[model samples]
Target chain A: MTRVVVDREVCMSAGVCEMEAPAVFELDADGVLQVGEPTDLAAVEGAVRACPTGALQLVD
Target chain B: MSTPTLDAIDLSERTFWGAPPEQRHAVFDLLRRESPFAFFAEPQVPYIPVGPGYHAVTRYADVEAISSQPALFASGSGAVSIADMPPDLNEFYGSLISMDDPRHGKIRRIVAKAFTPRVLENLVGNVQAVADDVVARARRTAEAGDGTIDVVADLAAPIPLRVICDMMGIPEADRAMVLQQSTVILSGGDPELVEDEEYMVTAFLKAGELLAGLMERLAAERLERPADDLTTALVTTEVDGERLSHQEIASFFILLLVAGNETTRNAISQGVLALSEHPAERDRWAADPGLTRTAVEEVVRWTSPITWMRRTATRDVELSGQHFPAGSKFLLFYAAANRDPAVFADPHRFDLSRDPNPHVGFGSRGPHFCLGAHLARREIGVAFRAFADHLPDLEVCGEPARLQSSFVNGLKRLPARLTGVR
Candidate 1:
């Protein structure tokens, strides 16, 4: 199983993560962070790296 | 164009145009601490009464929230400036940036189709070449003079102007005029740029006409002879089986030319000033080419180039604990939020290595986040890298001459030295 988490305190909500992996990350119209379970670990990691805030993390 | 001195003016005046740092930062700092959400009246315009006033959203979270909910805090009402723009100007000036979803989304997607990842990745080589040429010219001037150099003109301004021209396929003969008109438009009523206080309006109108005419010509040329450029891409790309008309292409050109040229140039000019003030960080960036990336990010954060944009409340909405009635105008102060202590540690310090740096210098999230961010970042990074490689020990030679507007946090002049290289 794979899980994702966000630290809202640091999240600027730039939404780069969403662009990298929209399936796993859902930033709202205003740019709130919403993480979903990902079937594709590669895409999830891409988002984790893309996040300027480092707000996204994946744990197995 | 006439700016009241900070000492002589009323502190409660609630104006940001050309105010000194002590006064300008005071309001932003106060708003971030006490009234993170508050209302202030727009400065009185010359001809007719414009905006009634606007609620400021200062906190980082509040900016994010407002940006996310564009539907609630709509952009169409007045996206260009806080002053209510006359309808004709609004339609002419407003492109994807000022529209709502469906339309905004569609236009952005069609535009995005032109800016493919490969095109951007390909631009890196071309961007670096431009950076090299820019620095070479600057070095020649520095070595010949008393090391006196106007970084804003000799160094910073050329990079973006060249890139935008290259990207848009603008004719070389017309590039000089486009730059001249844009400078006047974004100069923000500086007496040096505009004839008088009232001429600012006409200046912008004339500038708009100049750029629109240039774009329409380019659009027509690109259609006749499709080149490997954004103009050709804009004309050819179809959305839902519909292509962009000549007018839509011109609108995008106006948006891209102004936004692209001004933001990156200001960022570069301001970045030079910041680095000169913080030499240790400058040395750090110069020592390692890899550090240029982060340094560029820090500069963009430090100088929120686009300043603030206005959004109208579609319905009665509460933001940052303040109740805003429907039709209320909300100003998202990216310049303020970029420095909020809650988000950035030691918010005022110019730290190049600031991790988790999510400054909205490019404007925050939402469908309207800056489309040229990738290209802008590349421009800043490469330009700074070349500066470091050639003029590694540049120091401030004089005080910066700032632009006269609240909208673009621009540096009109920056005097610097090439140090030993001179």
Candidate 2:
């Protein structure tokens, strides 16, 4: 299983991860994104590729 | 353009770029009416209360004064809105935008070696090739009639992204990722697109990590086999006999990415919009390709894409009779300054022949003048020339979608149709 980690403090909220991997990285009411369980590896890669801040990481 | 008294004007509710059409028209009307100077006080802050330090200068002369004298009005404190910065991330990414002289001069000199006019001229050939390819692709799509192109997407966005990536020695496979990162980083203030701060921060950090890794590898590679690319140059070069740390180098790369991408993108979009709005100007360039250079400058001036930069005062400073106490933040409005009627006759009109055009579209004068301006000029010139030669019949197919962010508001979706492609 692949897992995702996000350093929340540095996010400028540009929304690239949510754009690329919506299923895995969903934004809550506070507009903070989290990696849900059963993360999609391809989508996670897309998220990683899409992120401008480099705030997202994958753990396999 | 006569100067206005303080009692005559006020800051409008709308963010300059994101203002509604009527409000937009009204704002410019007020600008023209008020002439050189207008005072703007900040409304309630959103996330954190931006102290009463928020004030604005909308006149060209006032902006010129502030920008020219970086000693009086410093840019090193930070350029973005204060409310947006998180506490922890403030000190880490130190780019040229936040540096004062001596240090600013030293780093600027070393980095300047990479972006010299000669280097920019050399990069012109590559810029032309990439621009031609992009315009050709757009032309082909536009030739299909209903195949209207989004100038922002098809032409404006990719060319700069590709050129900067190429200059940095980023791999072809990674260009898409680079583009993605550029968009995310550049669009930080856009409310519509950027919804998740945590995700954005996480993504931002990850990009830094990835690029830092890339920089480390590139540094090693350059040590073994130096190349002509900027990455190799930066890795090898030193400022004041001190080599740039990995962190500083990454910050520099990140700065180039932001500066190069959005500014050039807006220049292309805004240039297209200008020409489309003025078919005669379009025909002028289409007829005489030589005018593309002048046209690019005029478009940059008219668009004023990066808009204003915020500077925090270190001591009580008197600018054009306005007293800003130490720690007061002043937003230097470059867009309005670019359109100052006293400086340019018929300021709003896009005249290609306007020479002696000392427009401060690239951040007025001294300290924070855009480092990537030469490359930006080349990219805009190349892109416009290619478009003029190829997509002569291009027309806006739909209302261009506006990016919501005030920091770098530009056309996000510029749908267009074209003809005359064989």
Candidate 3:
């Protein structure tokens, strides 16, 4: 099973994760980044690389 | 028994718009023969009025002194030729190029960790491939019928534009518009392009908005699915327990897009011009392909696209032989300094083999010595080698058109004709 972690403190709500891998991450109503389910390891990995803040990591 | 009256050089009028090739070299020639270090009068901004006196430094030694000591001559003043800004744009100065220590240092560390030299070294083959492809296309276009190619459009434009896009993982479809927006945004001092203020303003805003949207989308995507791309690395890097904000990422993207494309493109276009003018030097490089690296450095000195950057003295300081009170303005001229006879032998000659060439084409030494220098050198050097090898008989078909911007002296259009089709 693939898992993901979004550092709440480091997440600047850049929304890049959501754009790159919507299934793995999304910004909350308050614009805070939140992790989602059905995480595709490759897609989530891509998002992890795309985040300018380095706030996301894949913990599979 | 008499002291020479110190006269400040008026590069403002000379370089107000882009200096023509002859005029550009003439100014540097004069600096080499006459005074290498002098003050430059403040360039007038047509509608905006703000007085900021600048002591221009032309000698390499003097420019080096100012650049190495950013504490003395800071880069936080927007790092532009014009000292004043329209209040609205003041708040948006967090980009790497415009920041001083601590903040600049912190941010640069994170970005550097992501785009390491090893990573850039890996991109060398890709850079060369892109240059080869672009040159091939230019040759094909020239052979098809027109028998003429605008070097800026055909040769100089694509290499950096595509390389940066690829590095950022930006889709190829978006490359052209991204390149166009970068050109529109950074052409700040060029009156010819900005003639229609309304058009320029609209384009600038639209470009910023487009970049912001791209950043947002990319940031969200990267957060979800980490990829092997610079944008992804930037969005994901952490420093001092603080993450970069969305605005920061957007600003970084915009800055890199403009800087990566503009500097490298100008280098390529200007490198071609340098080689064409110095046939012997060009022949030397062609004869021994190993000289590509040094040739790039020499071209950076020869072109030195960014002529001057303004700095303000925080505390009272003495530069060269003059003493200035606190808040004194200084303009460090990189182009003129590159030609100073003291630092470079046969400074006027564009020697491909010129070494120990500690040219400040990027910027003076210190905290802000061009974060993108490595990438630029790779792109420019590889591109020059490819052109020289493939288009062996390449020559400018007509008088190259100058980009009507003093800030970024590049060819707007370089009409060229090649002997044999690639």
Residue-level lDDT of model 3, residues B231-328, one tens digit each, is 88778876688788766788888888888888888888888887788888988898898998678889898888776776777789887777888777
Q: What TM-score against the true fold does each predicted structure earn?
A: 0.87, 0.78, 0.81
**Model 1: lDDT to the true structure:** 0.77
Q: Candidate 3, DockQ to 2 decimals?
A: 0.02
Rank ordering of all candidates by lDDT, starting from the highest = 1, 3, 2
* DockQ of each model vs. true complex: 0.10, 0.01, 0.02
lDDT of 1 by residue, B243-285 (tens): 8766677777788888778889999998888888788888888
Q: What lDDT score belongs to each candidate, Candidate 1 first?
A: 0.77, 0.69, 0.73
RMSD of each: 5.5, 17.3, 11.4
Off by over 4 Å in 1: A1-60, B1-15
C-alpha lDDT (0 to 100) for residue B188 of candidate 3: 63
For model 3, state the Cα shift of residue B419 in Å.
2.0
Instruction: Judging by TM-score against the true structure, name the best candidate.
Output: 1
* Candidate 3, residue B265: how far the Cα is off, in Å: 0.5
Could you arrange the candidates by DockQ from highest to lowest? 1, 3, 2
Which residue runs of candidate 3 sit more than 4 Å off their true CA positions? A1-60, B1-9, B14-17, B29-37, B86-88, B91-94, B197-206
